[model samples]
Target: METMNVQEHWQNMALDQVPLALAGHEVPWVREARLAAFERFAARGFPTRRDEAWKYTDLSILAKRASFAPDNIPPDAPSEAALNAWMLSRQNVHLMVFVNGHYSPELSYPRNLGPGVQLESLAGMLDENAQLPPELFDAVHEHTVLDALNTAFTTDGAVLRLAPGTRLKTPVYLLYIASGYGVSIYPRNIILAGEGAEATVIEHYMGTLDAHNFTDAVTQLELASGVTIDHCKLVQEGSAAFHIAGVHARQKAGSRFVSHSFALGGKLVRNDITSSLDGPDCDCRMNGLYLLNGRQQADHHTCIDHQAPRGTSRECYRGVLDGASRGVFDGKVIVRPGAEKTDAHQSNRNLLLSRQAEVDTKPQLEIYADEVKCTHGATVGQLDEDSLFYMQSRGIDAETARSLLVYGFLNDVIERVPVSELRSRIVDMVLDRLPQGESIKELL
Candidate 1:
């Protein structure tokens, strides 16, 4: 009898899912993509600590974990009453629900999108033989094994399209609920906005406390000239879950794109965001905040490419680490040779709340255009004792004052969120994690 090593185990896992993946996806090109991705993943396996991009994060435990593929999760959707706690307080938004990576139409709310708007699930479109993009899975970088796995085993996700001059009045909510432990979820979302199109999308991932699942998600977005899109990703997975997600956006001339990431809970998490400014006057803004306590860990990596003249990009990311948790931020900006007049700025700041907590922050700039203006900086520090003392002297208790300052540190990023209702929801979530948070509710 031969014992399979960790790498061999993962490769066999992907190999075993080949029949299921190819059987479910009927499109010729899609089937080819799945096989290609599966082969790549089976050959390379997961990234190791030596890989520069993944050097800071250790994924050794993933090899030892046993999990069921997306197709293996039972198709039973939970009752409406069981989802009350997970529903957003905002009642006017359009909704799409997924249970263990399978779309659930019965749980999804009905909505009337205006003319020139189309919304459909990935599975539904495939079943109906919809004309999908040949490059559906080609928009983002598939350098990591996590991405390869997602493409190989993606069960279901959302697809949104907006014709030229269309404007969506309400946000589209893509809620992914994890209910089965030892289950792996791969969700793939696609958004296409034509010229002068405008919309907002919210991607929320939540799960039960007992769920020890593995989630690998990816989203691809395309914006035409004069288009504007706002995207926010919220993660509240179980404490024992391992989650990895990526967002890739391509922008044309005069297009504006903004992204907000709020990472609140997970055993281990990683986020990757990349934006390509392919046309002049394109604008990209990214904001993120992560709060990690206990032994949790979260890593964020972002890149902005200025491929044309007059492109603009701005990024700000902050993290708060408590207990023995760890945080990492790596941001990069690149200006091509002809990308003159480009303006780019990036900043990463982290706060440590315990002696054992740690953070690794890096902000990088690679410029080939001489006329571009680019700047990047990173900071890692603890709470300012002086500021805390001043607040305590002003009749605020130590605990309340500390909580206020922590909230204040994150307020700037919260203020950048344009959706008011979502902003309030984020505030409430943050407050719940702070000590004596109820006492400072009035102050907010």
Candidate 2:
């Protein structure tokens, strides 16, 4: 049997099905844009190691072996017990669930959303002929093939809108679950926060362990002046799954945006986050943590663009790798011309718990303004032996001591999570996944 080239494989499986898949939903300009995006994907194919941005990660195996056929059949609604296990149970919060990229109304709780807030499915909105925002189907940047693919094939996801000056006391949960084997799913989400609005959002992705699934998701956020949003994303897909996700955010004057990302599962994962501070006095903060082991691979790329005067941005990402797993972090902060008084900082840190584990980290700062303050740095190393010894001297065994140290290292980022319930769940999840995790349970 001959192996198909990455470009040939995707062009045969995905590119040809765009038109028919979106047959009835095609408005003239929308259809044209989807076709154009498909053309772009066909021309560029997948990013290779030769590309500078992808130099530290490779997609050859995924492109050749992974499935590209769309999974149109929606899986059964999760049982009540299963839903309870997966949902973030709390008062005043709303939950929306999607199974294999299709909304499951039976499993979602859409009640009690106060005035000035709108929550609905993207597919539902399109079906009802609701006016869709132009940014919903557009690419946030011009440089990626995955974004083009997502734009061409996105079927269903959550859409959220908040009216001006509206403040929600509780967060909104968007849960995506993959159930079948050898399937591909694309989820697209759009969020619009009106002026002076305040809200929190959580996006959670999970899947069955036996499925050989591929998920490509995109999320776009538009924050108006004086708005503040706390956003968090958790990726806990199957260990055999391939996940690629992108988040693009634009902030207006006096707006504030904070992002938290957690990557705990998947065979091959790539996360891309880009934020643009386009108006004066805006601030952005990005933080992430990835736990990988057992031959897994995770790559994260982030870009922060300071386009206006008196803007500020900060980013910190941490990784913990064991067994033969690998990790990559590439972060860049840019201060454009005339963006004086800009303050930006970026850092990437990694912990290797096994001899075979490896990591590649790069932090960059590009400042065009003469009066800007910017700094970037990256570090890759193992846990401190002296600290482990200190714990061991306090009656803790070697394995327990190591686990405690590892948890302490990761807790730095976890502690910054603003939602108390979510933060507690994340802490428990991280401890349970660490090496010899059970031994440190009593200590926690």
Instruction: Tell me, by lDDT, which candidate is best.
Output: 1
Clashes of each: 0, 0
TM-scores for every predicted model: 0.95, 0.94
For candidate 2, the clash count comes to 0
After superposition, candidate 2 runs with Cα above 4 Å error = 1-11, 23-26, 65-67, 90-92, 139-143, 442-444
**Ten contiguous residues minimizing lDDT sum, candidate 1:** 1-10
Give the C-alpha lDDT of model 1: 0.84
lDDT of 2 by residue, 95-141 (tens): 88889888888888877889999999987776565777755565545
**Cα error, candidate 2, residue 367 (Å):** 0.8
